[model samples]
Target: MKYLLSNLKIDINNKIYLKDPESSDLGKRIIEHSIQLIDDIGFDSFTFKKLGIIIGSNESSIYRYFESKHKLLLYLTSWYWAWLEYQLVFSTTNVTNSNEKLDKAIDILTRTIESDSTFAHIDEVTLSRVVINEYSKSYLTKEVDDENKDGYFSIYKRLVTRLHDMMIEVNPNYKFPHSLASTVLEGALHQHFLKNHFKSLTDCNQKVQPSDYFKHLVFNALDTKT
Candidate 1:
């Protein structure tokens, strides 16, 4: 049986949280405020105390849901990946053309994020910035392997796998589906960074949509050369 994950609210993996933040208004506020705080202050300077002060709650109360800001970052990134997966499923559910489906997937994955009314608590615009700027740091730690063992990257892996499948259907003999999919994701994030810091090194935000550039790259890698 198939499941329609986007028809209803998407569930963030419970492993990423000490307690489910979706369970209460305070819990939801913790997530909502944390995103804003991290967006305003860099993650290195963010703390539960500061978050609590901003949210009008005790610092310890913040810990009731997240063990640390790192875990919270993990949760946010995980949530982004799961939500992206849902967008992929929802957008592709009706399309049958392999190339068109892959194009839509690339567009959804690479394009800028706008808020979705379906998830009112998540400001995807800020969250997308978090993913572009901070997502890599969530795993660039000594505990990365342990976190990986604990399934911290499962949602991200699943998103890569889903897109990789589409690439394989586009080119049955393609040998680097995993590499291609990961490159597309990492490449998109890097393009955003490049546009801000080192604009001349890349042509992503130039005259064309970044998604179009990415679709071009993905097809070229598969030797379809769109």
Candidate 2:
């Protein structure tokens, strides 16, 4: 049997419904509900019907926002990118010194890793699988051009490029590729949070914090020979 996600009509634009700005708010709420549900239950177990119940809407209402579950997941991925943009912009824009900027960047990374509120307990493994699944699909636009370097890879590349330039300014001796730094950051995140969540591999016995490990990785990477 089918269920209702939201009773309101939403315009999914480029989909079955008409474009309506009024639907944006509800659409965002529904996506947020989806994220929360994914955290509460595993992503594999999440469904539109379950989301509708959580959001006090119906499946038909959700159709107004998105035609299908896959579409909703795509929206969520874009939302995740937008949210990361928010974090990076705020963290990096105003810093005057290169060292200070790197410090701030690492701090941002730390917070992203440590906070369940930001990542919603979704681990890197599950997220990677989701990204890979979408990455394999044909792109309607050139936005997702690179097979290996799309989605989070694209986001991370941008971030690391900026941060690497800053590091160069701070230390003329520093010579490392943006990909290297990006990989380090990704590895740190995966080890601290993502792997733990998806792989069921715990890094610490108990009460181990990602921020602590993040600081260590940052120092090690910066201090080591490039």
Find the candidate with the highest lDDT and give its number.
1
Tell me the alpha-carbon RMSD of every candidate: 2.5, 9.0
Which digits, one per residue and each the tens of the lDDT, describe model 1 over residues 124-202?
8898887888888899999999999989999898999999999998998999999999988888888887776788888
Query: What is candidate 2's lDDT per residue for 1-226, written digit by digit as tens?
Result: 0012123231222432223313466665675566667656755687889988887888788877666665565554444433444566666787786666766666665443323233333343344334433422323436454522534235445656665675666555655646546655555555544544554564532455554565565556667322
Q: After superposition, how far is residue 140 of candidate 1 from its true place, in Å?
A: 0.5
Which candidate comes out best when scored by TM-score? 1
* Candidate 1 segments whose C-alpha is farther than 4 A from its true place: 1-7
Worst 10 residues of 2 by lDDT: 1-10
